[model samples]
Target: MIQRPRGTRDLLPPESRLWQAVEQTARAVFGAFGADEVRTPAFEPTELFVRSVGETTDIVHKEMYTFEDRKGRSLTLRPEGTAGVARAWIENRLHDRSHPLRLYYIGPMFRYERMQAGRYRQFSQIGLELLGADSPLADAELLLVLHELFTRLGFDDLQVHLNNLGDPEDRPRYQQLVRETLAASREALCSDCQRRLDENPLRVLDCKVPSCQVIVADVPPVSTVASEASRAHVVAVEDQLDRLGVPFVRNPRLVRGLDYYLRTVFEVVSPKLGTNAVLCGGGRYDRLISDLGGPAVPGSGFAIGEDRLVDLLPDGFKVRVLGLRRLYLVPLGGAARAEALRLARDWTRAGVVLEVELTGRSLKAALKRADKEGFAAVAILGDDELAAGTVAIRELATSSQEVMSPAEVPAWWAGRS
Candidate 1:
C-alpha cells in the first residue's frame, strides 16, 4: 500500500472536529478585532519570500520548498503566512481604501524541515496582520489578541517573552556590535552561527548551540543600542500591555528568527511543549510592505502554530461539532426506504441530520448500526407507520420510543436536550 508522504497528516474524525474548533475560535476572535479574512495562493514566485522575509532568514535560506514550474519560473510553497498576505495587500491595492487593513488568515504552510513532535514539514498557521498602523497600541493589541485566544482555548501557564529589535536605524548599530562580538569568538561558535554572523549578525543572538549560546550570553543587548525614539516606542507598548492587564517578560536577546521584524518583537512560550516552547512569534515589520513592492506601511502581527496549539489542548477535550442534529432513519420496506430518502433531504434542510438506510438493512440491523455509531436518536419507518402518517422515533440514550408526524420530526429533534 502506498503511504502518505512524511511530515503531512490526514485529519480523520474527532481530530478534524478539534481542528474545526480552533478555526472557529480564530474566526470569532479575529472578527471581533475587525480583521477581515484574507487568503493567498499556497505558492508564489520565489522572489516574494526572498525579498519580504529577507535572504538571510532561515525560512528563505533553508526551509523554503522552491521549485521550477513548466515555464521555468522559480516558485516556492509558502513557508509562512505574512509574506503572502503582504503581497496580496499590495497587488490588490487595499491600502488605497483603508488606513489600516486588518486581515487574518488560517491555512497550511509548507517547509522542508526535519519533523519532530508538534513540528511538521507541512503545518498550519492562524495569523492576522494589521497593515498601515505604526502606533505602539497596534503592537500591544496584537499581543492582547493572542492572549485572549489562548485563554479562550483553556491554555494556562503561558509566558509572553517581549523585546525591542529597535527600528531599522537602530538595528545596524546593534548588528555591528553583534558581528564584532561574535567575530572575537568565531572559533568557539558553531558553523551556522559563524555563517550567520556575516550574513545576518543579529541572528547570532538567536542561536541555540550550547557553545554559541554561551558566547551570545555575553554580547551586548539590542536595547543597549536602541535609539531614543525606538526606546520610547517600546515603553509605550509595555504601558499599553500593562493597561490591558497582559503580563509579559522583557527578554533582551529575543530577536525573532525572521529578519523583517523591527522595533517590537515577542514570543508566547509555554513550558508544556518542552524545548520547542514557542507557540507563537511575531512583531512589527514596518518596512515589509515597501520591501515587497508596496508603499511604506507599518504592520504588526503574530501566527500561532495550529499543530502546537492543538497539541496543548486539554486531554480528551472533544469539540462540539456543529451541524444538523444526529438522527438516523431506519426503513423496513421498499416504500418506506423511498419515503425515507425524500424525508432525509427535507429533514436535513430543517436542521436534522438524517442517515437513511442505503444497503437495504432490516430495521433491527439498522437500529443496531445506529447504536454502535453513537447516533443520538433513530427514526423507524415501516409500511404500517407510513400508512398511519407517523414515524416511531427512538431516543437512543434511554431506548424510549415515541410516535410523531413526519412534519414534526424536525421540531421534536430541535427540542431534544
Candidate 2:
C-alpha cells in the first residue's frame, strides 16, 4: 500500500468536523468584521516569495518548495499566505477598489522543512489582511480581530508577543548595533546565526539555537536604535490595545522571520502547548506592495496555523462541534428498508442529522453499531411499524423507547434538541 508523505496528514471523520467548525467560525467572525474572502494560486513565480518574504528569511532560503515548469520558469508552492495575498492585491488591481481592503483567506501552504509537533511540511493557514491602511488604529484593529478570534475559539491563555522592528531607515542602525554587540561572541554562535549576522542581523535574534539565544540575549533591543516615529507608532498601538482590553506584552526580543514586516510584528503563543507554540504570527508590512512592483500600500494582517489551532482547541469547543446528536434509522424488513430513504430525507430536511442503515443488519446488530458510533437516538422501522405508519425511537443513553407516528418524528427530535 502506498503511504502518505511524511509531515502530511489525512483529516478523517470527526476530526474533519473539528476543522470545518474552525473554518466556519473564522468565516463568521471575519465576515462580521467586513472582510471578504480572497483566493490566489497555490503556487506562483518563485520570485514572488523571494521579493516579498525576504531573501534571507527561512521561508525563502530553506523552506519553500521550488521547481521549474516545462518552460523552465521557476514556480514555488507558497509557504505563507501574506506574500501571495500581496501579489494578488497588486496584479488584480484590488488596490483601486477602495481605500482599504479587508480580506481573509483559508488555504493550504507548503514548506519543506524538519517536522515537529504542531508544525508540518504541508499545513493550512487562515489569514486576514487589511491593505492600504497605515494608521496605528489599523494595527490595533488587526490585533483586536485576533483577540476576538481566540476568545471565540475558547483560548483563555494565549499571549500576544509584540515588538518594534522599526522603519526601513532604522534597520541599518539596529543591524549594526546587533552585529557590534554579538561580535565578541561570534565564534560561539551557531553556523546559521553567524551567516545571518552578516547577511541579515535581525534574523539572528530569531534564532532558536540555545547558544545563539544566549549570545543574542546580550544584544541591545531594536527599540533603542529605532526612530522616535516608529517608537511612537508602537506606543500608540499599545495604548489602543490597552483601551480595547486586548492583552499583550512588549517583548523586546520578538521578531518575525519574514523580511517585509516592519514597525509592528507579533506572535500569538498558546500556553496550553507547554512549549509556547505560536499558533499565529503576523505584522505590519508597509513596503511589501511596493517591493512587489505595485503602488506603495501599507498592509497589516496575521495568519493562524489551522493545524496547530485545531490541535489545541478547547475541550468545550470540541465537544460542542463534535458531539452532534444524530439519528440512525435502522430499517428491518424489505418494505421498511425501502421506506428508509424517504424517512431519512424528511428528518434531514427538518434539520435533523439522520443516517439510514442500508446494509442487511439485524435490529440488535444495528443498535450495537449505533451505540458504538455514539448516535443519540435510533429510529427502528420494521414490518409492524411500516403497516401501522409509525416508528419507534430509542434513546441510546437511557435505553428508553417511544412509539410515534412517522409525521411526529420531527417534533420528537426537536424536543430532544
Considering every candidate listed, which one attains the maximal TM-score? 2
Identify the leading candidate in terms of lDDT.
2
TM-score of every prediction relative to native: 0.93, 0.98
Alpha-carbon RMSD to native, per candidate: 2.2, 1.1
lDDT, candidate 1, 109-194, per-residue tens? 99988778998999999999998889999998899999888888877689999998888888789888988777778888888887
Q: In model 1, which regions exceed 4 Å deviation?
A: 315-325
Tens digit per residue, CA lDDT, model 2, 287-347: 9999889998899999999999999999999999989999999999899988999888888
Candidate 1 local distance difference test against the native: 0.87
Q: How far in Å is the alpha carbon of 152 misplaced in model 1?
A: 2.7
Error of 1 at 202 (Å): 1.8
Error of 2 at 249 (Å): 0.6
